[model samples]
Target: MPLNTRILLDNRPRGEASVSNFRIETVETPPLAEGQVLVRHHYLSLDPYMRGRMNDAKSYAEPQPLGEVMIGGTVGEVVESRHPRYAPGDQVVGMGGWQQYSVVDASQPGALRKVDTTHVPLSHYLGAVGMPGVTAWYGLVKIIDPKPGQTVTVSAASGAVGSAVGALAKARGCRVVGIAGGPDKCAYVKDELGFDDCIDYRQHRDYPSLAKALKQACPHGIDGHFENVGGMVLDAVMLRTNPFARMAVCGMIAGYDGQPLPMANPALILINRLRVEGFIVSEHMEVWPEALAELAELVGSGRFRPRETVAHGIESAPEAFLGLLKGRNFGKQLVKLV
Candidate 1:
């Protein structure tokens, strides 16, 4: 039996997660059942949504029980396979959790997507070409169909999803404004990604002033809003939304752990005639091929660039996750297990 090190939730986090919340324990890899494959984790995708899984609160997905291996998505290489469909050395992406190895049944819905790393880096399968990239595409193309000359605003603008959205909007001929935490992130969005403007929300004392800044950035009110950090930011954006403006609510990283409360923005939503919709990335998985093609072409042509902030080693996963919640990650955050 293969010995694997896994990070398990030792205690539920109080507000923010720390190393203390996780315990690294060694365990034996379970014997592969029929149609199951054993995989050695190569890369782990550390996302903000995992914060919700750390608690026992009600959410779209179940919370991780104490002593249970923390849930995550990973890119791995199959080491042992009892399943005919998979074989040794096959690289695949799936819900593997924060562990050195995992056993996956091929029949599951999120079993794995086989990857060809000779063309693209295998890590890209867990980053730009994977979940975060897909989220940005579907939210922008399917949900918010930005038109030429329209003003587009993306919160958490320097992160993976935000950057992708801004680049896609710019490619579509729409003026994009990114709202991030600090000057460095703002500069990256404006100067590097070619966003028309960027707002450093941390420098702004009040949401009203932030709203004014956004208004100034957008001489015309925002035509579409990609909400990543909800709460006050959503409230501020809602105050200046154009009529028929669409909002793709991707995440609420602001309230994920600190405080669990519904934001007060319905009055503004009604007044501005905004259409806000919350969607899970999985909801649009079937249509991913089309989005992936466009994104891949843009990437290949150098039109779209993905920024990634990577933390090395499985031991760094907790800190990396906390960094994501604190907006410390510049782009998509990942942990290299190998």
Candidate 2:
């Protein structure tokens, strides 16, 4: 039997997550049952949403069970299979978790899906062409519903989902302004991602400074907002939004450390009549096909260039994930298992 190395959630985080919250162990792979396929993970996606799962709280999803393989999206190749739909050596993407291998039953709906890696790389499926890309599409296309020549501002502008959102919004002829943490990320967001303007939020720590920057960058006022970092950043954007503007609230990484970070200006939602909606991408599966098709085409054509920050091995996942929560990652954070 082959040895399967797995990372388990050892402790639920009280505030911020640390390396001690996880444990790595090796175990023997059990025999595959009928209609089951085994996959060897090549890459594991580390996302901000995983941080919310670390806390034992009431949310959209249940807290990740203790001492179990940490849940994650993985792109891998099928190594062994008894399922009729999948064969050995087929590339697949699934919820393989923070583990080297996964045995998935083919009988379950959406348990496993085959991916074509001829034009696109396998790891891209875990980042730009996969969940994050779909997330961008759902927020920008469905919720924000941006119009041409409108101004759109995105928080955490250099992140996986935010980067995609900015690019997609720009493609639709919207004036895109990005709010990132540093000069380097801001430069990339403006120069590489083609955002009309990029704000280094580190330079504007307080609401006054941030709001002033937003006013200067978006003189026409923000028509749409793709909010990833909520807290003070949201407050700044709220003050600059045009009347009847729309906002897609995807994440609130600022409050992930158990901090009570409330909106500084909730009145804007009512007074400005802004349409703000929060969403979890997993809840909307119907749009995946349309979103993935457009994303794949854009990525394949070099139009939608999504960047990634990769950690070399599974052991680096803990530190990599922690760094991601701290905005240390440049783009999409990934752990290369192979």
**In candidate 1, where is summed lDDT lowest over 10 consecutive residues?**
257-266
Clashes of 1: 0
Query: lDDT of each structure?
Result: 0.86, 0.93
Q: What does candidate 1's lDDT look like per residue over 74-158, in tens digits?
A: 9989999988889999999898999989988887766877877765677777766788888998899888999999999999998
Q: Predict model 2's lDDT versus the native.
A: 0.93
lDDT per residue as tens, model 2, 250-323? 99999988999878889989999999999999999999999999889888888878889999888899999999
Q: List candidate 1 segments past 4 Å from native.
A: 260-265
Q: Which candidate achieves the best lDDT against the true structure?
A: 2
For residue 161, what is the lDDT in candidate 1? 87
lDDT of 1 at 319: 86
